[model samples]
Target: MDKLKGKGKEAVGKLTGDRRKESEGKADQAKATAKDKVDEVGDRAKGVTDSLRNDDK
Candidate 1:
């Protein structure tokens, strides 16, 4: 969502040659991507935990 916006901004900045905005957008995109990856890992871990618990029962 926000990451997509950042990507769009980055692309626009690249097209316009605005160095500052481009850098900011890149940073935002990186942060968002990192957060998303973390969330995905957390979800996967929870799923595995749940499966193990169910198997034990």
Candidate 2:
């Protein structure tokens, strides 16, 4: 996952003292978290829609 990769990148960045890499890794982790939240919302929406359809029968 992006988060895992980001953690590795961050560790490497710290070891090498590359601020840019550390920042990039943090960004990647944030982006991955946001994407996961969106997916969770979409899944919840789909479940609601399915429940509504069943009620109509």
Candidate 3:
């Protein structure tokens, strides 16, 4: 969601020739990508824990 919004901002910035806006949009995209990676790692960790518990049974 945030990634998409950031992409839109980037496109709009490019269309309007706003360097500041483009930089901001790029920053937003980078932040969002980092967040997504964190979330993915967390989810995989949770899955591993669940699998380990199930195997103990």
* Tens-digit lDDT track of model 2 for 2-49: 999988888888999999998888888998999999999999999999
Better of 1 and 2 by TM-score: 2
Please give each candidate's TM-score: 0.82, 0.96, 0.88
Instruction: Go through the candidates in order and give each one's C-alpha lDDT.
Output: 0.92, 0.93, 0.92
- What lDDT score goes with residue 18 in model 2? 99
**What is the Å distance of residue 26 in model 1 from its true position?**
0.9
Pairs with steric clashes in candidate 1 = none
**Candidate 3 TM-score over all chains jointly:** 0.88
Ranking by TM-score: 2, 3, 1
Best by lDDT: 2
Highest TM-score model number = 2
- Count of clashes in candidate 2: 0
Show where candidate 2 strays beyond 4 Å: none
Angstrom error of the Cα, residue 10, model 1: value is 1.1
lDDT for predicted candidate 3 compared with the true structure: 0.92
Query: What does the lDDT come to for candidate 2?
Result: 0.93
Task: Report per-prediction Cα RMSD to one decimal.
Answer: 1.3, 0.5, 1.0
